[model samples]
Target: MIDSHNHTSFSEDCKIPLNEMIESAISKGIKHYTITDHLDLDYQDKRFTFSLDHQARREAIFKAQAFYKPKINIYYGLECGVQPHIIKEAEAVIQKEQFDFVIASMHTTHKKDLYTQAFYHGLKPLEAYKAYINEFAWCCEVMNEFSVVGHLDIVKRYDLSLNEVNLEDVKDEICQLLKIIIEKGKGIEINTSGFNDIFQHAFPHPTILKWYKELGGSIITLGSDAHFPEKIAQHYEEALNQIESCGFENITVFKHMKPFEIPISDVRASLKLDIL
Candidate 1:
């Protein structure tokens, strides 16, 4: 199985070192994965700003790749948390460094951290959902430098009840966003982080995956969004099952910013035999 997203100490919120995180993935039989540390420039919560030591992170990734060569394929990647205000700043960083993959994400709205209660203070659940989804749609429409959009419906992450946020209410905007993603040849990730959370489902949900497929979109990647060793490749079996049911026979894996397909059947069989 290929885990397309993860973080280490390079990210402001995570504490694990890159080598330790890689060792953990290797232990889990994940031979192909990417280290996508966070980089949200000019974020609202000064403490949550996702900046990185570019050269240092690059050196660490290269060292890991050399040590694990032939045994594991470790790709260097970045999870860029974007807002309209910092588009150029994000672009400059992307241009300056070379990344194997770039996962575009929206971690805040109006510079306020979405994970905090302050983001939802005045708005009802549905209101917040609409606003968040619209902001995400805008980002998707405007951003073209990313390989895939991370957690398209991540607003659900903060919702108290999954039922409180209905996709039908925001279907038009979501569809528009999906269309733009497809037109731009970008994809979405099945962020498995939601499985253990109160949301209790993958980000973008299965229905949205079906919608993307129905819209003639096919590129989809899987990510554990792991910040620690234990979280590496979390809930991948369930995610694979859901993607298969959504009519996807293959999943995208990236190398040097280019994506290729691997059959889900192969991944499933490998998992059943404890070989992957």
Candidate 2:
């Protein structure tokens, strides 16, 4: 199986060394993996703010590649924060670097939009939810070069008490975003981190995946979004089952923006530790 989305110390939120993370994935029988470290330009939370030094990261990735390749395919990648204002800068960096893959994510609504109580203090629950979805749609329209859009409904990560957030209300907007993503030829990541959380399902929800499939969206990737070694390929079996149930026969992997497909049956077999 291929883990297309992941993080390491290169990302501010994760402090584990890259080698350790890679080794853990290897132990989990992941044949290929990508280190998609985070890069957000202007985050509201200063504590979770750190920009990737592309040069330094690239060097570290290369070093890891020398050690990990042949045993496992190590992809050097980045998870870039896509916001309306910083899209240009993000694009420039993507153009300059020959990354194996790029994941566009909407981590913040704006420079000041942190996931704090204060950020959602005044707005009604519905308004706040709409605002978040709107920003997500905007990000999708602005980011054209990403290989996959990570976690279509990631705002829920911050809103653990989202009793009022209705997928039905945002379905049309989310479908619109999916259309744009399909038009751009970028895949959507089935982030398994959601399975470990309160939602108990992957991002965008199963219904969203069904919609994407009905809309003729074909490209999809799977990720654990693992920050620690143990979480590598977490819930992969369930993730594959979810994709198959959504009518997906294949899942995609990337190498410098080019896609390769793996049959769901083969994925299931591999994930079962059945490979000879």
Candidate 3:
């Protein structure tokens, strides 16, 4: 199996060492693994910083790549926390680093951290969703360097309504965002982080997969979004089953900043996974 998005010590929030993560992936027999540490510039949180050291991170990845060459394939990737004002900074990092994959994610909507009450302070649930989507669309419009949008409907994860609101409520807004993504030749990531959450669903919800596919947006990568070792590739079988149900025959893999497709059936079989 290929897990295209992950984190390590390089990301401020995740303290796991690089070797530990690589060892875990090898144990799981993951065919491909990408370490995408966070690069959320000017993140509002004073207690945590999401800056990355390009040289240090690349050196570690290369060292591991050589020693683990026989065991598994490792790709250097980055998860960028994008906002309207920080778009240029995000683009600068992309230009400077030759990362295999870059996940443009909006951790903050209008410079406010989505996980905090500050993001949802005044607005009602649906209004909060619209505000987040609008800000995301604005970022996508200005930034043109990333590979795929990470957890496109991440707003639902923190909805004060306990997700009492469904995607249909913001369907039109999401449709416009998807179109912009498609127009930019970008795709989305199926983040499994939410599967274990209270909502028991995938990030952006798996149903959006079919919507993306129907809209001619075929590029997609499956990521566990795991910040630790044991959690790598968590709930993948369930995520893949949902993808198959969404009419996707293959999931995306990236190398040298280019996307390649491997049949979903082949991946499932290799990993000895069945529908959950």
Cα lDDT of model 2 by residue, 1-276, tens digit: 788888998888898999999998888788779899998877667766669888988999999899887888998888888778888888888889988899988777744454665456667666666677688778778777789888877676776644357778877777888888888888899999988877768886888899999998999988889999888888887788788899999989898889999888877887877345
List ranges where model 2 is wrong by over 4 Å.
Answer: 161-163, 274-276
For 1-276, candidate 1 gives per-residue lDDT tens digits of: 678899999998999988899888888877688999999888877666578999999998999899998878999899999898888788888877868899999889866788874577778777777777678778877877789999888876775753576778777878888999999999999999989876657887898899999999999998999998999888878888889889999989888889999898877776666642
Listed in order, each prediction's TM-score against the native is 0.95, 0.94, 0.96
Poorest lDDT segment (10 consecutive residues) of candidate 2: 110-119
Per lDDT, the best of the predicted structures is 3
Position 262, candidate 3: lDDT: 88
Task: Go through the candidates in order and give the C-alpha RMSD of each one to the true structure.
Answer: 1.5, 1.8, 1.8
lDDT of 2 at 135: 80
lDDT of each: 0.85, 0.82, 0.86
Q: Model 3 segments beyond 4 Å from truth? A: 160-162, 273-276
Runs of candidate 1 exceeding 4 Å displacement = none
lDDT tens digits, residue span 124-231, model 3: 888888888888888888888888999887787776483877778887888788899999988899898878777566777766777788899899899999899988
Clashing pairs in 1: none
